[model samples]
Target: MKNLKLKAARAAKDLSQQDLAAAVGVTRQTIGMIEAGNYNPSLQLCIAICKTLGMTLDQLFWEE
Candidate 1:
């Protein structure tokens, strides 16, 4: 498992975890877990997150 890049991007956009969770239709705890690398979301959830954040899945989850 790897760390999510969400925290940095969200901070850059001035979005709180709760704000992102609401945008992606998930719980704040879910976002927290994702950020903490404690949860792996389904493809649909991943897509939702990427879409809401104006990023690609690779940008958020993949490492070189």
Candidate 2:
């Protein structure tokens, strides 16, 4: 199963799902789904998350 290290990283930074959702123009539920690995965001959404986290997609979302 894939994991959302992005969500974990965001939490480490003390960001709420609502906060990330607002920053990425997505719903809080969307962030929740992403965090739960129930949703695979589009490239645009991925980029938005990366930008908000001051990270690159490669840094945030990569298979281990």
TM-score of each: 0.90, 0.88
Quantify all predictions' global Cα lDDT against the true fold.
Answer: 0.88, 0.86
> What are the per-residue Cα lDDT tens digits for candidate 1 across 1-64?
5454888888878999999999989999999999898998999999998888888989998877
For residues 1-64, could you state the per-residue lDDT of candidate 2 as single tens digits?
4456887789877999999999999999999888888899999999999999888888887876
lDDT of 1 at 36: 91
What candidate 2 gets wrong by more than 4 Å, as runs, is none
Number of the predicted model whose TM-score against the real structure is largest: 1
Model 1 quality (TM-score): 0.90
Model 1 clash pairs?
none
Question: Cα RMSD to native, each candidate?
Answer: 1.3, 1.3
In terms of lDDT, model 1 sits at: 0.88
